[model samples]
Target: MSFKRVFKQFSGSTLPRFFGSDKEVDEFSQKYQYDPKEKLGEGQFAKVYKAYGKDDGLEYAVKVVDKRSLSNLDREGLKLEIQVLEEVDHPNIVKLHETFEMKGKIILVLELVKGGELFDRIVAKESYSERDAASVIQKVAAALKYCHERKIVHRDLKPENLLLVSETDDTSVKLADFGFAAFCHDELDDGCGTLVYVAPEILRGRKYRTSPDMWSLGVITYILLCGYPPFFDTDQEALSKKIIKGKYKFRQEDWQNISEDAKDFIRGLLKRDPEARMTAEDVLEHPWISNLAAVPDLPLSTMQKELREFLAKERMRKALGAVIAINRLRNTLNAFAFNDVDGDDDGDDDGEEGEEVREEDI
Candidate 1:
């Protein structure tokens, strides 16, 4: 894995065509069309290079994939990926400008986004501030919504898959790394998606749905606020167990300054049971995400007892319900211990005739 910082300041007067079907321009050689500049990044899938249109001077990201490197991969997988990309079109998703084969290597020309991988930013900065975190996730949510609407599930939605292509002006949170992307109607590979971020159902090798994408989003959200994955462990077996078990922690030290709504969002999406997890639409309507200003604070009452109560006993969520229930019950008096006769005045026990009372006292 590698990273690059792109600034989308296009000086081109004409609106750029997002996708071009014209792969063969016999009038222009492949190298004549795009001037490949600096190497943007390298990955198992392909090497990203900064390219500029020789005649148009427009910037682009060209992914170079040498067939020799991927000896194990087949042509059908490539076709599926291209088909998936063609079917998906969203602002947050990396735009496929063009594709062409040359020199026994396939090239994917895309919009050059330079913000680097989102995970890199979080790790480099230790953690994302509340506003920054909000901005990042909003773009992700938009991308996922677009994919889900088209019946395309990005099976692998790790942070590295998210790219930032700008620093100041042409800013965007574009989704990249679509090698594992597949259609919901397609047969799934048991070992698909990243292990650390894969949903529990996928780990169990079961037939699942789009919930895994939500699970990955939850993991990304957790990492954004807390600086690391929620259920991560070093040992492969242990990590696998934790992921399959869907165990998570909301340590105050780790989650300080983060909003209650944010936590709630993570908890619901990361639930062990796929059915219990929130859908893409539900996430869009969630308080924290829907209202940018609705992020919770500690001093305020929102993250206080009511919020805690909501968490503890909220009908639809299971994240911090246990702790909230305990805290909520603390305010409770536990009246189960009180005898009803002590407070009853409708009819006194002494007023009851034939009541067997004086037998056992010695």
Candidate 2:
């Protein structure tokens, strides 16, 4: 697959009239006032702005997608994101208030999360601990459990994607960015995710499903406790090799004060064999999360410093060229075939089916 296809970054030739009939653009204009100057974030094909409801006067994040810039594949991916966002309803998940199909663009009205990303929030904390980390992971795992029960895989899970709903509410976590999410009706073939958090199965070009997401969560959980990724390398090849080998350690310097339960939790999720990996339900019931009250409150001062340094490097890397890295990895993988003899078992127990709720109800 091409880099754009694998990265799902919406880089391709323009496509006109992809949304069929245009819904009245005034539907959004009449209800919300969006100022382009109040831009919150931007991606390859979309820009999000801080908006205000005309009557309710509530703040919102309005994501504007330039449909004319998307290819057919990009359009399909956007539709899938919208569908998944519409179907999910959970306290820890970001809310989509409504959608508008304009003449040349599509707009999504989403809940405006005032708090920053996960690591940043923790770094600002006066005292960080395993208890605090568990609290954050519990929220993420709860959201994932809800999604997995519905056969929806987030595909991408990382510190940047985890958001705090309020600037003052540390516990108000929300899982944001469904751009790479999909319903796992069968084994998923696409290997679309950031380089660091991607599962080994995806890097090997193997068919996978929810277990990949669990692996991602495992990586995130490791970073949460230690303030650095379990696997790290500046070179893409070296990094992928480390991940594929599934060999990471809890270094003595950083892990000396950490609890065994937390380490065990990470091991369970980071298993190389998908069948041996822990499910989202298992995450919820793990002693680290289940017995959170008993978790040590020893301050992770060194961890906070490491987190700050990690965040700085992350920003620099993004500015320099995350897209370039993806292209390089894609080119490297094109020459090889990583077919496994094992059958296509997703290695997750299906949870009870939940009722599908519309955005309005959520």
Candidate 3:
């Protein structure tokens, strides 16, 4: 629920810092001018603003992270993201122009994507078709294939991370956000990623690789055709259990109008075994993706209805999760305070010893 919690769960060891060790803050400050009024968004660690290059007059999105606000782990994760972004170059993947450090803030200059999230465009459409979804998926697959070839795995691949180049360009879906991405030569054992989109192997705590990305793509594909995720539960643990078991159905009501070829493609990607799952290249070659024009345009009113309901429910779940996390934190703090008072009153030499005695007495 919390960004810090997500980072703690996913982040690995620190790599060499991406920026030059000897570069001074003033040097970067002199190279670019940021427009204070043109703000994009803010996260826990950083704020993104629209900026322009003084020399070339090119527009860019600059993410500014306050060094003082970040932990060592947070810094490591940010550096790793930058490292991954620097190596990747594809039309479907958001480009990183450059990175700089200035006055205790790490600034990442990224390509400015005008059009919003991929889901926003789909939701805005009056008549959605399998062919439309396939076209979008094709672009995403191309991006993934490029990354996989370079040994980079985007651990987080959901609709939210997929963005369009422009409102009119339905085919130009660019994959954004590399915070949870990793480069691996062998299987990785880290349990990380968003809950519903995560692969079965990762949920089971088994070693996994780029195959999980394909699994996430399948989930996205499922949602593209329908409105909701394949695996859904109000409870996180229950949802995780479903994912680990790979227990999901097409629900006759939802799939009755959808094409069989689309379903087969999804099944191939969502296979329980990573080895059995389709690779990015394989997905690009799948009939549904390779020949989108042939896919039927079945009415998706039912899917649209379900998606609206799912979005509402997802918002509620996130709100509930935040409240629960806050309450748990408050309770722990209260208990710690109570223990501190009891320990002080008991005339104990060691605070931990008195706390243990109080806990046992309770």
Q: lDDT per residue, candidate 3, 170-238, as tens digits?
A: 668899999999988888867677877888666655677798899899899988887877776655565
Runs of candidate 2 with Cα error greater than 4 angstroms are 1-16, 19-23, 322-362
Ranking by lDDT: 2, 3, 1
What TM-score does model 2 achieve against the real structure? 0.86
Which structure is stronger by TM-score: 1 or 2? 2
Screening candidate 1 with a backbone cut-off below 3 angstroms (N, C-alpha, C), the clashing residue pairs are 6-114, 113-165, 114-165, 115-164, 115-165
lDDT of 2 by residue, 1-362 (tens): 11122224444453335342333565666899988899999999999999999999999999999988988878777878887888888999999888777667778899999998878889888978888889989999999999999999998788889999888887669999998999998988787888789887777777887988899999998888878887777666767665666667776788899998988888888776787899999999999999989999899998898878887877887898854443466557643325432333343321112121111211
Which 10 consecutive positions of candidate 1 have the poorest summed lDDT?
1-10
lDDT of every predicted structure (CA atoms): 0.60, 0.79, 0.74
- How close is every model to the real structure, measured as TM-score? 0.70, 0.86, 0.81
**Candidate 3 weakest ten by summed lDDT:** 353-362
* Candidate that would win on lDDT: 2
Residue 48 lDDT (model 3): 89
lDDT of 1 by residue, 222-268 (tens): 76665556664433454555565455676555455677777777877
